[model samples]
Target: MNISNYIDYALLKPSATEHEIIELCHNAKENNFYSVCVNSSYVAVTKQLLVETDVKVCSVIGFPFGAMATKAKVYEAKLALENGADEIDMVINIGFLKSRNYVSVLRDISDVKSAIGDTPLKVTLEISELNKNEIIRACEICLDANANFIKTSTGFSKGGATLTAVKIIKKTIKNNAKIKASGGIRDYETAIKYIDAGADRIGTSSLIKSSTHAHQIRNTKIYRKYIETIQKTTDSAKPNNTIKEKEV
Candidate 1:
């Protein structure tokens, strides 16, 4: 598996500098990553940097915390689209979901999806905050809201994506929507676990590592095994070989 094509190279840290974003775009272009996920403010610059490249620009809305008003989130999504973001990942209203106000939760997501039209919205459920049933319900709500993807985390949550969470999401989604497993996926082994558990995309910041660190990743047991498998087969469409690993 090349693995590079499924990645959404990300640099969403509040402290990320313009130089870092430039480096990120360069790395993504070099690796043929699927997209570069970033904060809304940097979308325009990222879009410009990745101009004429196959790499897409994705922006997050109501990140980390989803306590913002629905209108605010909608406005943010619109502004990001205007800034040239090709995809949107929005945090679901955790409070409303916990409050059992399904109507408001549905409205929050549907409104944003409505505003974005067909722009491919991925609703971040922040799975760390929810129980198994909650996770299933969130997947259903995302489907009703017409979200294109059900993301597992914002990577700033108390926990990151889990194998169990991905399984639950996959069971609930049943191909209705895709899954993006983000947070704490630090190595090729962990990334494969998520993919095996039914994740369509893996999101992490490890892919943006230094050259030395990148060498270490390439040498990891799972990565080496992947290389061996690639050399042994010409078929590239194997499910295991086609999953995405985004740099979040």
Candidate 2:
């Protein structure tokens, strides 16, 4: 399916060393993936490495968990943008969403959107924590807030992306926003199903692991951080799916 263009090559792991981050950016540029998603701390280096390439630099804000105050998130987003981040993937305040504080949730997303101003914000809903109605409401809020994408999970949570969830999300957004099916899409087949079901982008660490040249990384021992952890199944691993949890 040529998932390359639709992939947000991720490396959001706490244990990810500087060398691995550099290699991640270099490989992304060579593979022509849509973008390289990393924690905000590594955004600068990733951007610097991929400056001349077409790859976009995506930085996560209020990562893993989304309970940070709105002001803190805005500041974080601004700093990421200042550091050359082309995209911002922020976790939605799940606590607020679960508490039915839709207004706060919308405002949080809107404030960041306003700060970034067309940088393409992807709001991670952490779908596993919510019910069907909550997921739909979150989509509605994201659309209202003008978010560019509604990401399925953070991979650090209980579950990753699911086809049923994607379908439901697509049905909810109804072309207002795109769906980024993340969490656990390791192999080609699983990634394809998410695309077919309605995912616009596929976030996985499995690209390098599933590629014909996956062995190329073996000699370098570059796949150590995620040899068997983080991604539950080998079917849906993204480029840099690490289970390191950093709650805000």
Q: Give the TM-score of candidate 1.
A: 0.84
Candidate 2's displacement at residue 188, Å, is 1.2
Taking all chains together, the TM-score of candidate 2 against the true structure is 0.84
TM-score of every model versus the real structure: 0.84, 0.84
Q: Report residue 66 deviation for candidate 1 (angstroms).
A: 0.9
Model 2 alpha-carbon drift over 4 Å, by segment: 208-248
Candidate 1 per-residue lDDT, tens place, 26-77, comes to 8898877889999999999999999999999999999879899999999999
lDDT on C-alpha atoms for all candidate structures? 0.88, 0.89
- Tens-digit lDDT string for candidate 2 (101-123): 99999999999999999899999
Overlapping backbone residue pairs in candidate 2 total: 16
Q: Identify the candidate with maximal lDDT.
A: 2
